[model samples]
Target: MIKLIAIDLDDTLIAPDGHLPEENVTALAQAQEAGVQVVIATARGYAGTKRFHDQLGLTTPLIVSSGSNVIEGRSGEVLRRRFLPLPFAREVVAFAQAHQIALRVYVGNEVWNNLDYDPSNGRQRTVEKQVEQMAEALVEAPFQIFVKGNRESELILAQFGEAGEGYCCRHHVYSDGISELNILHPKSTKHDALAGLCAALDVPQEQVMALGDSKNDLGMIAWAGFGVAMSWASEAVRAAADWVVPADAQRLTSDPDAEVAEAVLRHVLHVAKDKKSS
Candidate 1:
């Protein structure tokens, strides 16, 4: 009965080396051929995730930036967007400055940063503009804010205790082991974005399958009726899922990132093929 599949990108659909495993890619294509709409939901921003959308040749709306933004894949048009209030954005900038760490601010299609580090995933960013004044640089509300450090997220949460009341303050680590803090509007969750897509497509909550392996994917995993958690996922995430799919054994596939493909093939393709013949 599933009509839509929401798969997280980095760990759920592709490997950590950023490789899109052939089996995973092929499974997605087969699902689409069954008349299912597939969406890539990720903590990655639009710029970071666009290439995968292009490669998949998907036309469904993409849920990006931990659900703060959703864009039409085919035309690259913003479908839904949520931005941090200007006041909060300014406060976040000030906090990062006081901590002496780099800050990356996402504003619409452009990414502004106070660091020399390239925020570009693959797309080229214009010459880095030094943000001298946090208040001035953040005149416009930002879509999201990113800060990286060794467990700096804990500090950020404690510091913003009273202020970040409703903000989605999640602490997670990058592939390289550097911990990161993601700051965004309270409503910026993949669950919220995926719900919106379901409303648009007239797909019921019980007919959606979400697969993920991390905290960022927690929202959608718990919200979807046919939720799937990677066996290697954190205890909290696995606890929230209806089913926990194992990370591939060397026999099914050696790749760790493409582990969720098993869930798709088993749950999605089997049902679709059954429906076709019946």
Candidate 2:
């Protein structure tokens, strides 16, 4: 029987407009009431993810920064963290500065950026400080780095042989004109983090369900006992999922929030019942 449920944030749980549907809220509440551990696994930082955790009143630890950091929700204590090696981080910073790529570096609780702030960027907190001297400012190893711009610019970042080798890189296309490259330690993956979480909870990997909608979500989806993909997920994401919820079924005639809630509730009920009967 499934003992844990891990959900992705963007494009999976939250709508494109950044709103969490009421349906999803209710379904998750029901799951918690049923004694299943719910975990939010995302590429977002703690500051960005805190609101969702608070909204759900989650007590379990949260997987953040694409699994580079896992922290307890209520107590706000860091459980695990993987930081980029200092030399490698410096090399990445130097490369980004040389190419004039707009970059953001996450170090502990702070975020440093090289670009002007814009509300539409979707980053929950404002950049704490601007890196005037990228090299000097990046002395400490960062948990993650975000590079934003066109594909060509991100491709340029892929050239740092050894420096890039030690890190897991994810490319995201926000629009025709905007793309983002996320860098984290090679070991920092949702699957790895979930494994740790399961061990802590004394649950097996086969007793966990994961839900997601993007390439970054593939690891956990593949690792979970039951992996669910959203209807609008990419072809790769769909292929990785054990089940796919059709867009129409997810939304029905209700709002996106309600649709998500209903879909989650239906799936959870069926799975739990099946497990019990078997």
Candidate 3:
């Protein structure tokens, strides 16, 4: 039987404008009431995702920073953390600086960036500092580095071929034509973090359902027992999912009565109920 549900934040759970669909909110409450554990697995940091967690009243540990950090939701205690080596972090920063690309470095609870304002498309928890100052402040390894620009991720990958040997990289292109590059330790992935979470919860991988809509969410979608992809997801993401939600079900609208959330949750609830019955 399904015991856990891992949902992504952007596009999958919330509308493009960043509002949670009421249908989704009600569905999530119903799932919790049914005793199924729900957790958020997103590339967002704790600060970016905290509001939704609070809104949902989540008590489970949250998988943030694309799985580099997992913290207890209720107590705000760090449960697991993985960092990229200091040398790699330095190399990545220098490379971004040379390319004039905006980079955000996540170290513990603070987000360090060279830009005067948050460069991660309005993400929260940021502190502006010069690249040199940010590099020097890396007393320990950072959890992850995010690069934002119009450049394709493959270009960055090729440039870091040798330097990023031990690191893992993923990219997501937004609807507004901006692409983001995420650099992290090789072992830090949503799938790896989910494994750890499963271990802690005594739940098997086959008993979890994962929902997402972007390339960064591919790992978890493929790893989970039942993987769901949003209708507007990229071809690559749609191909990887076990099920694909229709566009009508995920309409891009400002309507408060939109049923995107309800459509997504109904499928999950049906599968969970079937598992229990079987």
Backbone clashes for every candidate come to 0, 2, 0
- Each candidate structure's TM-score, on Cα atoms with residue i matched to residue i, is 0.88, 0.87, 0.84
- Candidate 3: Cα lDDT at 27: 74
What are the C-alpha RMSDs, in order, of all predicted structures?
4.0, 4.2, 4.7
Among all candidates shown, the one with the greatest lDDT: 1
What is the per-residue lDDT of model 2 for residues 133-164, given as tens digits with 9 covering 90 to 100? 86777768898888766653455556753235
In angstroms, the error of model 2 at 211 is: 0.4
lDDT of each: 0.79, 0.76, 0.75
Write model 1 residue lDDT over 191-223, tens digit each, in one string. 999999899989999999999889888989999
Candidate 2, run of 10 with poorest lDDT: 250-259
Ordering by lDDT: 1, 2, 3
Task: State the TM-score for model 2.
Answer: 0.87
